[model samples]
Target chain A: MAENPTPTPARPRDAAIGTGLGRVLLLVYGIFALSASARALVQISSHFSEAPLAYLLSGFAGLVYIAATVGLAIGGERGRILALVSCSIELLGVLVVGTLSIADAVAFPDDTVWSHYGSGYGYVPLVLPFIGLWWLWRNRPRP
Target chain B: MNGPLSLATIVVALVLGVWYVIRCALNKAPSNTDLWSMLGLGLLVVVLVVVAIVGLFGPDRPADWTTFVGYLITTIAFAPVGVYLARLEPTRWGLLILAVAALTLPVLVLRLQQIAEVTSG
Candidate 1:
């Protein structure tokens, strides 16, 4: 595509902590971080005993989002590794959780972020990990 | 959420979504005016959230008051967050952020309505 002719000045390799695109991803990741964590906070505070499994899963998803945000915000070798691992886990989490939620409804009495491919959140949670992974892959250190 | 205010926010958001998508099609970053327009939309959202907050005092208050509050915070913050991110890129992606936020607002509003529907009464 003729779009995006100018490469971002801040290359991911150099670990320039903040680029425009990084800023954008930070916003999105930040939102997810806030939402997931907030969801967990509310769920746990009101009724932790209702469904410990679902509540814990929601908190885990929030942590992954927070990790991804920090990784993208940090932007270096370590950051890359952090982002890579978190996004990979996120992908697996979403796929497995989505399937499990559908296959066995009794287990998931309430919704986690990844339940049913994040259908509750319009599947953005499902798609976000893929995009996060792609961005990290694109910016991976060259051999 | 089921009120005119929520509907207005959703409709405005959708219209803005289309506008931003068109701007992206043209490969243009958000201009100063665009940012201002976003801020204006943010004002509208603020009003909507305020109204929703007032609704909380009514006897029809939803059972899930805490979750309703959570959505209120998110809805109000949405536009400014978009503006902040859009300012950073100065490219089509900036507009895309706006587009994403605009599209997401409707969902947030819907969620608010859903939570509010399960009232204690």
Candidate 2:
């Protein structure tokens, strides 16, 4: 409305989330959730037999994304833990799968979300976990 | 998906992306004006999506029209979703939300173009 600006308030170490950085985190997570699921749907429905491993990885990626989204949206101590666990698993999954997809191309005839460290998606899958972890650390609750 | 409409939508979205990125870097809270501009962009996207809908009925329908239609829903709803989140956040992150949406629009538009190219009528 007015040019008047609201001084950015310090967020609760825990109470409310998705206000500042959490909002951006949510947006990114939302994007991943949508894209992973959409891509899996396309691959599995069209030609699952062509590359079952890759397509299944896509679906697994989608599930993790959904878990992360719910965890972030819930926003609490346990919520943060859920988000942390999911994001950490995501990081490891992407790295391991990403390396496998690249190092052993024959094993992956098709691509997953983490294929080649998510080069297809601008390396966002690779980068997202670090951001997620950072967000959680920043919002660590004061018990 | 194949007309001046989609092209314009991409160009305008990129421009808005640059604007939002700059705002985020500067740590500015999203202004009402920013929201209005986003709404304007949303209107443009609506126009492009509607045109694609009309194209769907025409003689050259894309194969797997279902996915294309699904993307159309995502594309049309994207900006308004960003605006709603941005409004709730009211900070630099809000600007970042706009930036993300603007960046995403081009991807969706490009996907629409690809799907439209594989026609079955």
- Candidate 2, residue A108: CA error in Å? 2.4
Provide the overall lDDT of each model, using Cα atoms, as 2-decimal numbers: 0.85, 0.87
List residue ranges in candidate 2 displaced over 4 A.
Answer: A1-12, A15-18, A141-143
- In candidate 2 the C-alpha lDDT for residue B13 amounts to 95
Candidate 2 C-alpha lDDT tens digits along B1-121: 6578888999999999999999999999899888888999999999999889999999999997878898899999999999998887778988999999988998889888988999986
lDDT of 2 by residue, A1-143 (tens): 24438776643445325367776778889899999999899889988999998899899999999888878777676778788889999999989998998899999998888999999788999999998888778777655
Looking at model 1 chain A, which ten-residue stretch has the lowest summed lDDT? A11-20
Clashing residue pair totals per candidate (backbone < 3 A) = 0, 0
Q: Where does model 1 exceed 4 Å of error?
A: A1-17
Candidate 2 TM-score to native: 0.87
